[model samples]
Target: MSLTHSVNMNWKLLIGVLAGLLIIGMFSGSSGQQSSSAGQQSQSRALEASNSVEWKKVDFLELELPANIQELRDQVKITSGKAKFFDQEIFYQTGAVPAGVSRSGRTVLLLHGAAFTSQTWIDKVPTLRTLAALGHGVIAIDLPGYGKSSQASVPDNGEFLARLIQSLAGKQPIVVSPSMSGSFIIPMLANPQYRDLISGWVPVAPVSTGLVASFSSQLLTPTLIVVGENDRSLGNRSKEDLKGLPNATLPQVLPGAGHPAYLDQPEMWHKLLHNFIIKVNQANSAQFMEA
Candidate 1:
């Protein structure tokens, strides 16, 4: 071959190799940029979840709960306290958020039925410990004239509850009101001033549900009305009355359970409570972001 022809051929090969490398570099740079952008978006979402990047990594639904009640009770550390409101000292048992877990930025208040007290929640069910283990502050309270609390009755149930909730759970607490506590909760639900203080409500066959049943359309607080399938009277009645609330969900019926449903179906009850609390916090976080 002629030298000139050979030189021309080598030049063509060099040009071809250079063109290929340039194309590869363009694609590599684009791919790298896309990866970086995706990472940034993920981080932004983490930050939006209550200012805690750790929350994005943790899924409350996947967290483990102890199968043994005694072991769980032992594993969780709880304390007792009394909050004075309106000349009445309310007795309560509280559990703090567990270690190494990001706080959900929410609290849970457990109120008992007439037959039960604050200890009933700890001994009969896994409400308090499960909530604490899942990174939420939890409190089980003995209403006035019950358990360790003073025998003096509350003059204004709604006002007393409002004070107690603010003093104990802070703003936006998820309240678990079972049986007779419904009288206190229903009144609070009807009052517009206390609406923002409570994040969510679990009315477990509470009494005096009829008071708000007619005006439930105006009550916008997120409510989860739960009852037992076997509890034909109060359970069904409470659901019927409170289900009309604007933001209320359908009655969550626990199968084969009775009036104090959580005692008979603790696992299912805890699962529902966990899911509701997480959803409430998520909604609040979203609202905060939008605002």
Candidate 2:
């Protein structure tokens, strides 16, 4: 063969080899993109399944007004209900649907301090009636051993509360936990599964131990931390510890209030709760529209 023809044939072979490599690279890139898309879809489906788990309802006794609750009986009606969780009965109180306030699909789950029962919400803040009047569903529960709920050896109260929230609200409900109940809730925010099921949090003078520091950055839910002006230590700690939360509000310290600030300043607490609920709901609505 002529030298020039031989060199031309070599060049054609080199072009063909380069073309083959280009095709292989394109195919690999396409497969990688498909795999990434599949991964995202799987994650979305798993989250939806986690959020959609159904809870069974259990029988509950009628609430007989104790002397502590008798004074507010006429102003707001209360009903008792129970749900079974792992052979334990979880009792809860539901405030009556206030006249002219339509069910807004925005539910609030009230968890009280260690010393208080579900009645404390109504007795102290009248939160249930106030929330109901604002067109929200209100459920105040007696944590495992408190009030009428049966106690069990709960290994993880955070997981237990997450399940209780799922069962009670049938969707992501706004959680309002005061004092010791924060011990259970703040940790729950670390678990993505539990975190996905909650819409928002209102932690009032919560007992923040070491857990707050580790999981503060992992919090994805909208949070509001409220403390009393008198409870400076906890108020300052919460403000500093929870600064990592992406969607947290500036800590609100009620004027002239003590540890149980809600009891002393019910009106301010109610206003803040109402406003937070509205803000969260609006954000959720905007997200839904964007999606």
- Per-residue C-alpha lDDT of model 2 across residues 132-211, encoded as one tens digit per residue: 66668889998887888746446688888888887887587899888888777876776655676777788887876457
Best by lDDT: 1
Task: Return model 2's CA RMSD, one decimal.
Answer: 11.3
Q: Count clashing residue pairs per candidate.
A: 0, 0
Instruction: Tell me the tens digit of each residue's lDDT in model 1 across 15-132.
Output: 9999999999999999988875764454343234433223223333453354544454456788998888888788899886655666777889899888989999788887788888
TM-score of each candidate structure, all chains considered together: 0.75, 0.73
lDDT of each prediction vs. the true structure?
Answer: 0.78, 0.72
Residue 67: error of model 1 in Å?
8.7
Q: Which pairs clash in the backbone of model 2?
A: none
Model 2, backbone clash pairs (residues 3+ apart or across chains), number: 0
